[model samples]
Target: METNNVLKICPPEDSMKDCKTDIKCPIVNCDKVVFSSGSLRMHLTRSHGISESESDDALKRRIKVDPKVYKEYHCPRNDCLYNINSERHFTNMAGLKQHFLKVHAEKKFKCSKCDYGFGMEKDRKRHESHCGMKFTCTSCQCTYVSVEALRTHCNRTQHQIPEMYTK
Candidate 1:
């Protein structure tokens, strides 16, 4: 007859403590430290507004696991509004890498009159306003820094666009 393992008595210990490991916040400049990966995930998702998959990837990068464990790629930018505003989940490393390259890595807005580029559209517009290039609407006598603004003014006033600006 075999003895059941349940019959053997074990020492009392904190099960939660046994499962806990020191994990730090992966976001740059964040000084928070949590005990378990699950707790860290919760912190990242709720406190930092990071997506679940992104937090999972962050956990994977910080923790050691089996070689056969699946890998997940996450956006490293903590201030990325795209990820925070919506639950953007990447299915593969390529998609995440592409998002970083296209969205975070490079400037998305450029000044039309200058070589300067900006990561935010508002920053680009502010810079363009002071870039020394001005477009004036002849009909309304209003000045704008960008041709797009002038075009908008023309549309609002029902003014015809100059032939030179038609293109």
Candidate 2:
């Protein structure tokens, strides 16, 4: 008979249903009754002075995350909304920092035509097509296919166009 080496971590859906009613802390003499496993883990760490590693070990034993899968880094910020379905964990601080910069940092590229901003040059370029900056002659109420054509019309008709129209 061949043995399977893969470790499967199945969620405790049945126990979770029971946890909805009652789930007490594992620490002795602690009468805290939490409604979920996460809350119980938090209670263990905050109220009983249990370290996060200890609570994580106990949780792993209960929930069965693969022991071979080494997940060390975790987002310390409670308000971090990334990875809601899976564990909000990373392999290193650099990865977490990159995620924070990409998601939370201010956009660097600002569109001159509108209030739209983008984090990347390509995204800003893509926005320019729909930015409503098509060559339009305000004096004649005519639209041209190109800025050169609009400039020619303005020069020939002596129609004064706004400086923004040349761009």
Query: Using lDDT as the measure, which candidate wins?
Result: 1
Q: Could you report the Cα RMSD, in angstroms, for every candidate shown? A: 18.4, 18.5
Residue 46, model 2, lDDT: 61
Q: For candidate 1, write residues 131-154 as lDDT tens digits.
A: 977778878778887778888889
**Model 1 misses residue 140 by how many Å?**
1.2
lDDT of 2 by residue, 1-167 (tens): 12254222322323312223246687788787764456676667567656578546656445544555544343333456544234545654345444443454456668777867754444566777657756888898888755767889999999987598655
Q: What is the lDDT of residue 64 in candidate 1?
A: 41
Report how far residue 84 has shifted in candidate 2, in Å: 11
Q: TM per model? A: 0.33, 0.26
